[model samples]
Target: RDNADNTYTESGTRKRMGRKGIGKLAALSVAERVKVISVRDGDKSGCILSLNISNKNADGKYEIPAIPDDQINFLKIDETKSGSAIIMENSRYSINKTIDSAKRNISLIFPFACQTFKIHLENLTTGATATIDDTTMDIVKLSDALLTFSDEDSEYNEYLNALHGAFDNGRYYRVLQEKLPPDQLPAQKVLHKALTTIKEKMLLVTITGEQKAFDLSICGWIATFASSSDKKRNTDFPVNHISIIANDKLGQFDILPDISTDRMGEAYVVGQFFVDLLEETELPDIAASNRQGYKEDDPRFEKTLELIRKNALRPILELKADATKEKNYIRDLEKANKAKESKEAFDRSIREVVEHPDFKKVIHDSQPVKQALETAWELKDTLKDTYKKIMISHSSDDKPVIDELERVLHFCGFEKEEILYSSSNYYESGFEAYTDIYDYLKNFFVNTTRKTDLCVIYILNQGFVEKWDPVLEAGAGWVLNSTWYPMYTDTFSSVRRPFPGTAYTPKLNFDMDEKQSRTLAGAIYRISQHAGKLEQTEETIFQFIKTTRLYHG
Candidate 1:
C-alpha cells in the first residue's frame, strides 16, 4: 500500500477504507483451494484463486477455471442483482479454533457494523450463528462504570441514556444500596456528582514542515469492570480492548498500550474511538502498512491519543475512586464503632473477674487467676489516673490550635467528659453555665476541699499573653501547684522573649522538622502518661506529628 505501483484506490461518495487491491491473495494463506464468484447484472463469472502463479496462460496472466453459471446463482438470492462472494474450501483457519472464536474475531475486527451493513457468521457443523450490528457495545453491559462521548447528538444521547439507566436503576446501584449504611449518600448520587460534566476536546495538528493544520476529533464510549476475568465476562473473548476505527473500518484492535498509564484500572477499561479524519482523502496517508494502525509519529494520531487519555479515560477512573472511597469509609466507620463497644464490654467483664467469690484463695497459685490478676494490674497501672479532670486553658481566638490538641487527647484514649474546654459543648451542661466565671475557676482550680485531681494545659500564644482569663488560669495553676505544661502555638519569637507571664519558659520550636516533631511527641506523651491515658507508643505519636496536616507547612 505504501508504493505507488501497487496502490489502487476506488472513487466513491464515502472515503474508501482500503487502498491496496491485494485482499484476494490473503485467502491463499488460510485455505488450500479458494473459489471466487461474481454476479453483475445477472452475468456470472467464476475463478479458482491459488498461491501458485506458475500455472499461467500464454498471455502471462493467471489462468481462470471454468464453472457453471447456475452454481454461482444458487449461492445468491433471486432479488440480488450484483455482488461478489469468496468461498474457501478445506479451510485451515476455522479448524484449529472453535466456532465462537471465529464469531468473536469477526466482531473484534469489524466493530462499526450497523443496520445498513451487517456481518453474519454460521457454523455448518454446529448450527451456531452470530450477527454483528449496532449492539456491539452490549458486551460491556455489566460494567461497573461507563463514560461515553460523541459529537453526533443522536449517538451521544443514546449512550447517555444507557449510562443513566445502568447507574441509576441497575446492578451496581442495587448492590451498593443493600450493602452501605443508610446515613451515607446513595451510590447513584455519588456517581452522578462525579460525572456531572462532559466536554468535547479537539486539537489542531499540523504536519512537519507544513503550514496546513488538520483538526483531529476523538469520540467513543469507555467502560470499566470491577472484575475482568473471562469467567466474569461469561465469554472467552477478551473484552478489555480499545479499538480504533477510521472510516467504518478497523485501524487497530487496541491502542491502550500506547496511551495507558499502566494503572490497575487500565486493565478493566475497554472502548473504541472513531477518528474519520485519519482516512481523509486530501491528506497524506498516515496509516501503517495494511491499515493495521497509524504511524506513531503522525501528528493527527498523537493528538487523538492525547485527547483520549486526558478526557475519556481520566473521568471514568475518578468516578470509580469516588464511589470506592465512600463505600469503604462507611464500612470502616461501622467496624470501628463495633470494636469500641466490644472493648468496653471486655473491660467490664475483666473487672468482674476480680470481684469473684473465690478470687483470693486461687489468686496466688492458679495459672488462670494469676493471668487474670496480671491483666487487672496492667490495666490499673496504665489507666487508673485517667479519672482526673483535664482543663485546657486557652483564649477563644486560639480555637484551631486547641482543637488539634483535643484530637490528640482523644487519640490517647481520653473521653469527652474527662477533658473540659470553655469553647467545647461537652462542658456547657456543667455547673459552670449557671455559676459566675471567676467563681467557677476558683472552685475548679484552688478548691483544695474537692476530691478530684486536676491537670491544666496552658495554651501559650500571643492571644494567651493579651487575654486576662488565660493569665488568671495560669496564676491559679502556679499557686495550686497543679500538674501543668505550657504548649506554644505561635513561635516564641512572636510572643514576649524569655516568657514574662508563666513560671517556665515555653519551647521555641513550631517549624515542621524532626526536632519539632520529637518535641511535640514528647510533650503529648508526658501529658498522656501523667493522666494514665497512654495507649500508643512514643514512636507512634512521633509519626503522627510528622504526618498530620496540622503540623505540615
Candidate 2:
C-alpha cells in the first residue's frame, strides 16, 4: 500500500523523458479521488490507500490523512504475488477517452516499454479490451523493420543499388549536390549512405553537429517515408509529427515547426532529434513539465535547433527550390523546341509557295493564299524586324525627310522596331572595309529570309544620286527583286533614273505640308497592305505617283 501510494507522492531526477517529475499530478487534476491497492508477499489480503483531493483545508491545499495498516481497507487479490493497481474514482473525465489518450501517449513517449513489459486496457461498460504493443505504432515498426536485415544481405544490397540509381536519375539532386559547399559533401554522403541501408520504406537522414564549449553533440535521424506514396500506405498514425527524442525516449512528439515551412515536406517527415547533452545534471532543466517541449532560452535546446536548421532543413529546402527551377527550365525548353519545329515547317511551306509557278496567280484570287503569304512575312519578321518588312534606304543628307516619314509611319500605327535605316557613318564604319555595300545589303535582306517581299523606300536627292553607297543599295534591292518606292526631294531638279522596267516604281515628293504628309502616309499604308502578299493594283500605284506629282509641282 505504501509503495502504491508513493508512486505519485515522490519527486525524482531526470529519467528517459527528462526531469518531468510532476507528470503524476495530471491524474489528480482530472479526477476528484485516487485509490491505490497493493498485494505484497507478507500481506494475507490486499491493502488499499484512498485519497480525496476534492476535500481541502482552509489554505486551499489538500490535507492528506495518514491511515494505519489496520485502518486500511482490505480487498481480495488473486492475480499476482506482488502487484499494484491505480483506480481513479468519481473521475471528471471519461474513462474510455482517458484510456485512449494514455495508449497513444505511452506509445509515443515510452515506445520501448512494450519491448520489456505488457500494457492492457479494459472497458468496464462494454467489456472490450485493447493491448498496446510496439507493433501497433508506426515509428516502432519502422525501426524494427530497419534492423531486420544485415548489411551483406541481398535485400540490403538491392536497396543500396536502387538508391544509387534514384540519386543518379534525379536531376535536381545532382544540381543540389553541385551547388553545396565542398566541405558539406562529406556530410551529405554520410546521410545518403545511411538512407540506402535502411530496410523499411523510409528515408533516414542523419544530421550531426558539435558544440565544444557545452560538450554537446547534436545528433539525430530524420526518418520520412521514402515518398508521399509510402506514407499513404499506412493510416493508423495518420497525423504527421516529428518526435524529439532525448537519449532513446521521446521528449517532444512534434518538432515540425523547427524543421520545415513547406507543408508537403512537413506532412511526409517524421523524425527524432537526440540531444543527450541536454539531460546533463549541470545543465538547467529546459524541458516543459508535460515533456512536450523545451524552454525557449535553453542553451542545449537552442544548439539543437541551430544544427537542425543549418544541417538538415536548409539543405532540403534548397534541393526543392533547385528541383522547381529545373522543372520550369525543362518546360520552357520543350515550348521553345516546339516553336522551332513549327517555324521550320512554316518556313518550308512558305518556300514551296514562293517557288511555285501558280503562287502569284492565286495571291489576289484566293484569301487563303494571301493569309499564308502574310504568315510567311510575319515568320520572317521574327528573325530581324529591321530588314524583313520595311527598310528606308537613304543618304545622310535625307535624314530630316526620312525621320519625318518614319515618325508619320509610326503615327499611322507602324511599330518603330519594324523599320530599318543606317546613317552614312554606320554604313562606312559598321561594315568591314572590304565588304561591298551591295553585298552587305544583300546579306541583310537575305538574313531576314524575306527578300521576295521586302519593301525598300528610297529617298532620292542630289546626295542620294552622288553617293555610291545609296546607288549600290538601290541596285541591291533590284538584284533581290524587292519592291522599291522612290521619294525625291522637290529642291533636287535632276535625279538619276532607275532602269526602264523599274521606272514604273511609285514615286513620292519629300517636301510635305500637313495635307501632303497625310496623303503620303495614306499611300504608304495602302501599299504596305498589299506588299506582304506581293500584290498592288495599277490604280493605287498610279494614285501614289500622281500624289507625288501634285505635291512636287
Candidate 3:
C-alpha cells in the first residue's frame, strides 16, 4: 500500500479461497466462459491492472486469460488540455460486492478502488465505516494533538498547523469579552499554528485507522454526503445532520467592531474558523491539555441593550443631549476603519508574486508589484530555480505545426521533459478519458506534488468554436497572473454551464501566428522569472509534444 501505488496488495496475511485474506493476494480462478467487458481510456498510458474471479474454478491457481483488445476501454482524450477525470461504469456488482470487488472480497477489497479508503477495513461487510468515540474528534482537541504529530505527512502536518492558528484566534476574539477565560488565548494560538501549514487548494481528506474514528452516525453522513453519489438509488444514506448545522456550529464570530470594505478579510477569517475546527476532529486528548481553550467571556454586554428594551435609552439620551451626535459619528467612524482593515488583509494574502529588479524589464509597472517584492524576499523558499519554460498557443488542427515547434525547441536546448501541453494530449470524449484528464489537471492545481510552471494552448479556426480551447487558455493566463483571479466573461465556469437562450457568449480569438513559439516562450519565461521559480527550457517544453502531440515549440 505505497502512497504512489493506487492498488492494494495482501499485507498482513493470506488465506485459502474460502477464507478472509485470500482475495487480497491475487485474482481468483474463474470459469473459461468469463467475459471481459470493461472500461478504459483512449490514452496509451496511465494503465491500471484489474483481476476477476468466480467461485467455480476448482484449481486454486489463477488460470488467467488475457483481456482482448476489443474488451479494453479507453478514457476520453482531451484535444485541449492535459488532465484526467473520474471514470464511471455500468456493471453487475452484487449488493455484497463493490464495483471493483465481489461481495465476498469487500474487507480485503472494495466497491470502488482501494485508493478511496484511508486504511484497510472490513467495510466489505459493514456498509458503514467503524466509528471511534475519542475526544480528539473535537477540532480544538485535534489542534492540540498536532503538537505531538511531526511532519511525516505534509498534508496532515499542515492540518495540525492550522489548528494551532485557530486556538490563537479564539483568544484574540476574547478581547471583546468582559470576563474572558484565561485559557481562551492559548487554545486559540494552538489551532492557529496548525492552520498555517495547509496547502491552499486541497479538497479531499482521508482518515487512517489510528486517526479519529467518527460515530456511526457521522460515518453514514460522510458516505452519503461526501463520497460518491448513488445513481440508481438517486440518494445515499443519511444521518443526523442537525448537530452539524448549528449557527454557532463551531464557535463565535465577531464583526470587526465596524463595517468597512477593508474588514471583509476579517469576515472571511471569521468564517474560515469553522473549517479548521472540523478538520482536526482526529485527536481528542489535546482538549484535556487545553483546559482553558473553550472558555467564554460573560454575556453581560446584553445589559446595555436591556436599557433600550426597558425603554430607558430615549430618556437617558434626552437628558444627555450633547453625547447623541458624538455617539452617532463614532459608530460611523468605526465602520470605516473596519472596511480599511479587511481590504488590507485580503491584499496581503493574495499578493505574493516575486518581482526581482529584472521583472520591471519584462512587465513594467505590473499591478502585482508588491507581490513580486515579497516573492523576491522569499526566493530561498521556492521548490526549484532558473528552469526554462516555454508556452505554446495554437489550434488542434495545426498539430503538425506544434510538433514542428516542439522539434525546434529540442534543437534549441529544451529538454524532452518539463513541458505541459493543454491542446493536443487531452480527452475529447468518453468516461474513462474524462476521469484520466480531470485527475491529472486537478492534482496539478491542488496538490503540492504536481504543478506546472509554463502553459501552452493551441488555437485553430475550427477549434475556436468549441468550448475546451478557450477554457484552457484562460486557465493558463490565470496561472501566469499569479493572483488566481477568476474570470467572469473570459473564463468558462466549471460550476455553471452556458445558459440556453442567452444573448451573449464569448467568442475566442481564432487567429494566431503558427511559428510564434519564440515569442510565446518569451512571455512564459517572463512569468517564471517573476515567480522566481524553476524555468523550463524552451526546447524541453517543445520536445515531448514533438514525439506525439501536434503542438510544438
The candidate that wins on lDDT is 1
Angstrom error of the Cα, residue 460, model 2: value is: 44
- Cα lDDT tens digits, model 1, 42-155, are 788887777654566788887756667777654444525778888887776545355666666666667766677788777777777777775454544556566666544534
Models, CA RMSD each: 12.8, 22.0, 30.3
| Model 2 weakest 10-residue run by lDDT | 141-150
Model 1's TM-score against the true structure: 0.56
Per-model TM-score, in order, reads 0.56, 0.41, 0.18
Clashing pairs for model 1 are: none
Candidate 2 lDDT over residue span 188-233, tens digit each: 2211223311221212111233222444544444433434555554
Evaluate model 2: give its lDDT.
0.50
Q: Candidate 1: where are CA atoms >4 Å away? A: 1-13, 25-29, 32-34, 60-71, 74-76, 92-98, 152-170, 179-210, 229-237, 323-334, 346-553
**TM-score order of candidates, top first:** 1, 2, 3
lDDT of 3 by residue, 34-75 (tens): 332343344322322235443334766654445555544434
